[model samples]
Target: MADQTPNSDAYRRGMVTRRSVLGDAHVDRAQANTTSFDAPFQKLITEGAWGTVWSGDQFTKRERSIVTIALLAALGQDEEVAMHVRATVNTGATREDIREALMHVAIYAGVPAANHAIKIAKGVYAEMDQQAAAKDR
Candidate 1:
């Protein structure tokens, strides 16, 4: 893997992580929307975020989920935070991770943003739990 160029490895790993984290339907929609204007940006993120960072051995997916949730919340990116909260289930992140990340967000981002993010996280978590419960039955 290290022998390959960053772009190639990144693209490959990004595709894997993108599908695993975002799901095929969401990734398919994003791929369908890709245009010449945004292609480079998409590639960059794929390589940087999925390929290099996510592929690292340092952190487990669960840890990454926590960090990502905290960062997104701190940035006040509610939509992205919500998406990541949804992704957490697949990444081995439990509801506790979301709560802890939100706590961090409150300290770093501000109370208002954290509060809103908490609401969004709770809603996403409720849906996730309901789905899990239904599947078990």
Candidate 2:
């Protein structure tokens, strides 16, 4: 945490929460790729998304993961949806939870958006399965 830049309480909490949700390897890669151009944007999400909202005690990580995936799907954030779908492993969001969220998306958002996100989720799950299988081998 000391190595993390921006000496703010929010940033510190954000880093911890973000790492817990996204995993150390993903966070490390993101941090490593940080540059002058996107530093501010990165900081904002860390503090706002992770530190403030995500750190709140109101919602469990699993609930948050489901809502996040649905919102990203509605917004057509393909990459974000895929990333969050993968994060479900850490967040304790089961495939059943995600499926229900996408069902909600299909009704409230659009069938096409939910359809695309479902495709993305299936691909991510398959990829995760492959990784797990590799680990067991």
Candidate 3:
């Protein structure tokens, strides 16, 4: 983990960005679950990944979402892939965008990786749909 302080500006900005992308419920759960052993790790991701990379203005959140999903898929990060796929709702990435990204992943990464990521994405979508349905009831 980076030697970044939790009170730093980067951490603060990252918390907002992380919450924006991952939702308050998820963020809150993650924070609640943070242990002393993993606290530094959490700070590193929040300051570096969320603050520096995600907070950059070059790519729209939608573009970042598509790229992140593809990279996570290629790397066989199943859980991260699903999390990012769910985050597409907040990022404004449509299903079509995710489909295209996975197509590229199939070609560039591997069919198996893309296939598994697609499966995860589908599962996340189903859960999201179920949540939406529950809200409507």
Clashes (N, CA, C under 3 Å) per candidate: 0, 0, 0
lDDT of 2 at 100: 99
Rank the candidate models, highest TM-score first: 2, 3, 1
The sequence of per-residue lDDT tens digits that candidate 2 reaches over residues 1-137 is 22446868888899999999999999999988888778889899999999999998999999999999999999999999999999999999999999999999999999999999999999999999999999999
lDDT of 2 at 136: 100
- Per residue, candidate 1 scores C-alpha lDDT tens digits across 29-102 of 77788777778787888888988887788999899989998988888898998899988867898888779888
Q: Against the hidden reference, what TM-scores do the models get?
A: 0.86, 0.96, 0.93
**Candidate 3 deviant stretches above 4 angstroms:** 1-5
Model 3 per-residue lDDT tens digits across residues 73-104: 99999989989999998999999999999999
Angstrom error at residue 53, model 2: 0.7
Preferred candidate (TM-score higher): 2 or 3: 2
Error of 3 at 41 (Å): 0.5
Minimal lDDT window, size 10, model 2: 1-10
lDDT (C-alpha, whole model) for all candidates: 0.84, 0.94, 0.92
- Could you give me the TM-score of model 2 versus the true structure? 0.96
Off by over 4 Å in 2: 1-4
